[model samples]
Target: MQVTQTANKNVLDRVFKLSEHNTNVKTEIMAGITTFMTMAYILVVNVNILADAGMDRGAVFAATAIAAFIGSTVMGLLANYPIALAPGMGLNAFFAYTVVLGMGYSWQFALCAVLIEGIIFILLTITNVREKIIDCIPSVLKHAVTAGIGLFIAFIGLSNAGIVVNGATILALGNLKDPLVLLTIVGLLLAAVLIAKNVKGAFLLAMITISAIGMVAGLVELPKGIVSAAPSLKPVFLQALSVPAEQIFSLDMVVVVFTFLFVDLFDTVGCLVGVASKGNMLDENGKLPKAKQALFADAVATTSGALLGTSTVTAYVESAAGIGDGGRTGLTAVTTGLLFLLSLFFAPVFTAIPTQATAPVLILVGVMMASSLKEIDFSDFTNAIPAFLTFAMMPLAYSIADGIIFGIISYVVLKIATKRAKEINLSLIILS
Candidate 1:
């Protein structure tokens, strides 16, 4: 047993270079588990959201897990980065609500758009255009991106836990008297306290604590079954490829495909920038290493996800949680991928982990990541204004791509107006 264990460790070390990244097996595994626990909600949420577009719920469920597994595993092996990928939250809404329901296009048409976008992404990565664009982002804006994502994540947590809700006032606090909200507050406080004590795996511990409390308090329902039969993917599989050639060449197709390409490109870039900065993975030039491989993995996931009858698969900002938990190597991503595959059979149990339980984890990671704000140089008004807009627009506009778009345009306009065009790169001008 000891020799077998040593052999397995050797293989992991060679593959992930865990020691070189200064992370061990136990830490990476915990980080992966923490990430999977927080992100597992995508399985059920993606299915429900896609179902509105008239897709099969069971098939979408299967697709979500399979896409996650493929994306995360490929990211681990191809790029050796700890980041995990999944069907992105905002992208899915646009696929279902805007493209399919609002625009009256079929879901298959939307999937074709997604597939086209993925192909374009792969091409961009191959040409190094994507990596160059990421590098063109100014250092201050990169830090702002991290802070913006932190705020965005925190807002998501608050809204998910019903601690924040829309009102005539635009935003208002939830009733503290409500049992669920009260429980959320308890979890929030405990997480904060754990973080203060410098506890290892504080976020994971908080989630577990809240889940247990909620179950005992009759808030979180227990799963009906520990394991279940896997769902078939046949209903939605390869439907994207079925779009007629005439439809594919239509103007509507052009517009839809462009929209998908634009959104996925920037959202993935924002996620990579935000989470990489939070994890201190970027170099002095504000560039991530092996970015081509990372991006290629994302592109492949999107194409596969579309073929499997889902929306765009992109790198997730939630990955910062695992990075914050000491995940520095691909081992973390591989572990998360394995869990996603395992979740296929254990869907009920994974789905039963309430949003309230993961709420504290998201909120805490937000606080931790927001420290990047301190790194921004507020002394320069030119930098300050764009940076502020970049971070603010994320949660306010409820879109990471919008935040980046606003920031880049403003930065370029400001620089050109101020006669600092020499400081701007050609890529920046094109991006604007």
Candidate 2:
């Protein structure tokens, strides 16, 4: 037993390059725990969103944990980056609201689109298409997309918690005196205070707090068990294959595919560059080392996630929490991955989190993503108009696809009409 333990330790040390990265098994494991704590809210949040799109809550909970495991594990072993992965927030919202609910497509059909998007990303990354694509799209639009999704999902969060409702004026405030709305309000404030204080795992803590209060007040039902077998994946697994042949060629299908691809591309690039630069992992040219391997890792996880019945799995910015906690190697990520695997048994606790309990996280995540808006140059309305339309249409039109489509179209038309045709690239023109 001692010899076998030594062999396992040696393999892990070599495979994760712990010594080379100046990290140890103990530090890596602790960082991994930090990473999981920071982003653990996804187990509850993802299920709440996907369940609205007519999925099984238990199954999505299991799939979410499993996919995060695959994503972070691959990131650790393949790219050797200290970043974890999970079903992204914005893309999942788009999947549920814009594609399935608004566009009137089935959730299975949307999953098919996500699978295609992942496959395309894999091919594109292999051909070195990511950098060129990133360079082609204007930074203004990218910032706008992020901010738009923020506002859009914040709206969803508000709606879910019954803070906002359809009224005589088409939209109105819910009765603040109501129990659910009041609880959601308290959760949001508690989460805000926790975040303001820079507390670790603030979101998860807020959710648990509100949940406990709700249970005592008889607002949320008690769970049967805290730890049990993972739910069956049969409901959501392999759903992409159920997509009809005609869906592959339709105009809406193309639009859906482009939205997923563009958002995933932007998100992956932004998270990697942000975290890598923070970790001093960038090279002399301001490029991430082993960039292709990292991209391929994210792509593979995304494809596998769709097969496992979840939305686009990409690198989580929450990994930055772990990075700040002294995680400098892939072992940190591998540790995070294993924790996600362990979370499978706690699906009952996750699934029991009321919709209102997750509302604060959705709102706070929106605020974080929307910060990109400050980077946009709004001094000129030429750039400002498209940017405004981009973010505005998302919440107003109730569709992220509409937001992207309107932004690109308005951008191309505005630029050409203003004698700035040179600013519009071939890809933007094609996208328009």
Candidate 3:
């Protein structure tokens, strides 16, 4: 047993650089569980979202897990970054509601566009074009994007926990009298206290504690079973390639493809920079090392997800949860990926984890991501205006692309108006 344990330690130490990152196997494993608990809602959420496009629920559940497993594994092994990738929240919504439904395209055609977009992403990453784009983004704006996503994540958590609801005006408080909302409130306070006390795995412990309370309070249902066989993916896998040639080559299809490409590109970049900043992974130049590999993993995941039957796979902001838990090495990602794969068989147990249980983690991680806002120079009007817009528009517009677009446009306009056109680069001009 000692010999086997030593061999396992050697491999983890060598591959993940755990010691260099000031982490260990135990901490990485716990961080991985923390990250998964916070984001496991995606399994059920993805099914509901994609099923709107007429995809099979069981198939999408399998695809979501498999795609996340593939993306996180590749990211861990290749980039050695503690980031996790999954079928993204906004991208899936766009795929189903915008492209497939509003654009009158079939689900297969939408998947085709995603596949093509993934191919384009791979090309861009390999040629270093994506990295160059990251360089063009100003530091202030990067901080703003990070803070904006923080708000966006927190908004998602609030909505999930029934603390916020769509009111007749805008969003109003949900029923505080509801038992679930009360539980969420208690969970948030408990998590805050645990974190403040510097409790290790505070996030994970809070989740488990709240979940237990919820179960006892009859707010959360116990799982019907501990394990179940994973669903088949054959229903939708590679089915997009069978679309009619005419439809595939249509101008409308081209527009749809561009939309997917555009959203996935900026969203992934924004998420990586935001999450990496929280982990102190960005260099002085505000660039992530091995970013190309991360982007490539995202691209490959998107393609494989479409082939395996899901929407655009990209880096998730929820990854910041792992980083917040001291997950500084790729072992965290590999651990998260393994958990996702294990979830395929233990779906019932994971699915039983209620949203309210995870909601507090999202709220807390959002606070951590937003902490970078202190780095932004609010004294400069040109920088402040765009930064403000970027931060505000994320949760308002409910889309990362919209927030980024507003910020870039405002930045260009402010620069030109202030006779600072020299600061504007060709990349920003083109992007604008």
Q: Evaluated with lDDT, which candidate comes out highest?
A: 1
Ranking by lDDT: 1, 3, 2
Q: What's the CA RMSD of model 1 in angstroms?
A: 1.0
* Model 1 lDDT tens row, 1-432: 999999998889889998888878888988998889889999989999999999999999999999999999999999998899999998899899999999898999999999999898889999999988888998888899999999999999999999999988999988879899888889999989987997878778988989999998899898879999999999999999999999899999989889888888999999998998888789877789888899999999999988888899999888988887888888888889899989889999999998988888888888988999999888877788999999999999999999999889998999899998998999899989
State the C-alpha lDDT per candidate. 0.90, 0.81, 0.89
TM-score of each: 0.98, 0.69, 0.97
Where does candidate 3 stray beyond 4 Å?
none
Model 2: ten consecutive residues of lowest lDDT? 130-139
lDDT tens per residue, model 2, 1-432? 999988887888899887887877767777777677657778888999999999888889888999999999999999899999999988999999999999999999889899999999999989977755444557677677667767776787798899989999999999899998999999999989987887755666787789899999999888768989877898999998998889878999999999999878766765675566546676664556778888888999999999999999998866765665567889889888998888888766645768777676667766766776887899988799999998898788876657767887999999999999998889778756
Per-residue lDDT over 1-432 for candidate 3, one digit per residue giving the tens place of the 0 to 100 score: 999998999899999888887889888888889988888989999999999999999989999999999999999999989899889987889889998889878899888888888888999999988888887888888999999989988988899999999999799999999999999999999999988998989999999999999988888999889989989998888987888999988998899888889988889888888888888888988888888888888999998998888999999889988888888888888888889899899999998999889998898888988887898888999999999999899989988778888999999999999999998899988888
Q: Which pairs clash (backbone N, Cα, C closer than 3 Å) in model 3? A: none
Q: What local lDDT score does residue 361 receive in model 1, on the 0 to 100 scale?
A: 82
In candidate 1, residue 327 scores what lDDT? 86
Global lDDT of model 1: 0.90
The positional error of residue 76 in candidate 3, measured at the CA in angstroms, is 1.0
